[model samples]
Target: MLIPTRVRPSELDRLIAAVDPDLRAPLRGRVDLGGTPLSRATLAAARNSIITPRPLPAPPIAARRIAGVPGAPPVSLYVINQGEPGTRRPAILHIHGGGYVLMRADDTFPQLQTIARAHDCVIVTVDYRLAPETRFPGARDDNEAALRWLHREADSLGVDRSRIAVMGESAGGGHAAMLALAARDRGEVSLVAQILVYPMLDDRTGSRRMPRTGIGEIGWTSAQNRFGWGALLGVAAGSSVVPSGAVPARVPDLAGLPPTFIAVGSIDLFVDEDIDYAHRLIDAGVSTDLMVLDGAYHGFDGAVPDAPVTRRFVASRDAALRRAFTPGGWRRG
Candidate 1:
């Protein structure tokens, strides 16, 4: 975390004014999430209070402990199936966000229930280990194990293995991206699509490259971003020799990845990095859809679920998942 816990006065001079009308109330006069650098000192409180999101009612959620990666502990999973039993359908391996340092999987069951019912699809939300205590490959391995378990049990779970997708928000988005990449490089599991909502992609974002003005002044800030990255990697953020297959943004080749749908707020710190990642995906001949909401900030969809921009983001995500799960497969741009 940087000195001067709150955002600099210069950054806030225009950042607050640029936020969406509906999204301004939460940011108005607020010190951008307590104005504290996320450290072990503040991590506990942030985990308990920072993830206050409004989600829908959930169906009966079945808890299961599945086998983990070799030599690792078992992974926890929440399997939700809204479709008829024995009816094969599309599935989404949903990963929850907490900047790779906070939050849990089951805390988001309410929202997962909505998606499962709406799509009549099987959903498997993973409980990947968080950072600081568990770093880098720990969470990634948990997700990979869950993905493998899903693919392995597709028949018994009434899921169509060919139509599975990976999705997450914020840090969860980073995990989803990493899972997609590992799935590709390992050739063990094939993903139909990747839906990343305002994902934290690059460590260099707030470290090497200064955050753009008007963004990161609210919600998740550069200071938090730096801490989050360092916690995950167990090293300085934007360090040169990170472990292989850790950071999605640092992966050299983007070709052969599944179709990707990315959504980011206009004033979210990740807007530029997400857009650039989308561009690179397109350049790699992959089908990529990017939705940038105007006057929105990080996590605005959850903050103001009923806002117009939020609705648009939700619609785009659903539509992208639908297309990817189609029988014929996703259509290229």
Candidate 2:
């Protein structure tokens, strides 16, 4: 694991001080959890303690670049040049994970910066508009435009358009998948690959009940998933009918998409959908890699970086990205 060890005793002291004494037991007991999705209110209640988010250490290099200045709406840009430079490097446009509601390019700065530098690629983190405020297509449009912008200005940015990949986590992952589909359909932009981490693929809920013993411990719950999807769709989540662009699962066709790396924690709310989506991609003749992390949940990589499970998660992710971005990409096993 590249992550430095965070002393549990010291970290727990900070967590205990931040949280209510009464809830400490349950939070500490969460070292083991089954697949059952925890309640949103419960998770929210423990946010201050159990789910403490520490910004990743700063990257060695960093910069920002204007991605797009569409005459309509706001001027959107890409945060670029934050990694070590490599000759004939591949470029990746990253979409930050937030269930499509919160978080932004800047919020995930540490992780993105690390990725940019580690991969030695021109990593561009796009600032997509959030849902409810911007609605469905708005976010997708920004993503597509960013890819188009990447292609159009590839020369200026010293990136190879042919080596472009789309990467994101959670809802951002879903958007990255959708962007590949959209780009394929419109013939607007070409993508070399996509990396989706614990992606929330379906707007609709799944019938399979969560299991009780693995990554389910500290991951997002069914309730949280509902809230996120509802907020993004502007309607109750798990609706029998979802409009296009609202959910990747609802998209009619899955053909002609780019190669994809789909990752999910066994206990994640989107686990089922992520699995099914990967299968669908294979069915459509699109190359796909599916990585199922055991004893891990949504945001596990960021949540408990010190855990052995999460250490393997990050290592796997890095290796996957390296393979995906390698001069000649490899196929899934």
Candidate 3:
């Protein structure tokens, strides 16, 4: 298949054209001979580049202590409540994408605000522990604890515990999926749905050792995937084994899980695994919705928000989430 050379979104074309040719080269996927694997500092810088702060802000609805977590520090919950104080709305526990290494509550401000406003739901975006220092289960534990807290205080928060959903992007998406699995096994903290956007599901990097297909169109290369996974798992990039919770795909028995919305760009490295996981969800009797956007790459929605295709992709995701929040039988797409 021939990959079309990506052009800047029409709105940004002039701005992109005005940029120095050298800078534009990198944006166009041209690698710099001098550029090496980002140093810790450089990696941090690269991460920041992708997470542009939302200039406009919305105030959080309100916050209160739900359930006190044992041993760990108190989780400060940020909530955006919709409707009256007594009436309930669907709730979402959002986890931000950052390869499980970097990101903050503020980073997801725009998305949370939009969801809260559009869906009339309470959106809780957590500030979870990062990896390297804090590995697998650390973030998961924090997420679970937060979920438990939310369940306990659902009444006070005007949320229906049964209507709760878990949503996340990238590594956060992986965590959300794992949390759904963990909740199912526990048999108490039932989740209504899971929204996983371009999630990194499998830690078994070698599952497909064949040469990576569609390199340029995919955006994120094999080297970067290994680096992020290695950092999160606290092992060498190509290590022979990875621990459980390190990767969502590592968990077996995806049966009896809630419905799921799994999406990925056709060219994303995670495309194969996401597709496989979606099949597993369906095989296990879980309702699954999958979208494969053409001529797009990993993180395209955020990376190129101005592009028409990117907007269409984002709209599909938002619509999926909205349908999930609907009561009774979910509206099939």
TM-score of every prediction relative to native: 0.93, 0.77, 0.81
Per-residue lDDT for 67 in model 2?
A: 40
Prediction-by-prediction clash tally = 0, 6, 0
Kindly give the stretch of ten consecutive residues in candidate 2 with the minimal lDDT sum: 1-10
lDDT for each of the candidates? 0.84, 0.66, 0.68
The reply for model 3, stretches above 4 Å from the true place, is 1-52, 55-69, 82-84, 206-211, 216-219, 237-240, 331-333
What is the TM-score (0 to 1) of candidate 3? 0.81
The number of clashing residue pairs in model 2 is: 6
Error of 2 at 58 (Å): 6.3
- Sorting all predicted structures by TM-score, with the top scorer first, yields 1, 3, 2
Q: Which digits, one per residue and each the tens of the lDDT, describe model 1 over residues 1-333?
A: 111236555565466688888766665664543546789898987777744445454566788999999989999998986345566899999999878888788777777888888788899999889889998899999999999999988888888888899999998999999999999989998899999999989998888988766667666888888999999999888899887878889998999999999999887888889999999999999999999999887878767788877788889989998898886658653
Best by lDDT, which number? Answer: 1
lDDT value for candidate 3?
0.68
TM-score of candidate 1 on Cα atoms, chains taken together: 0.93
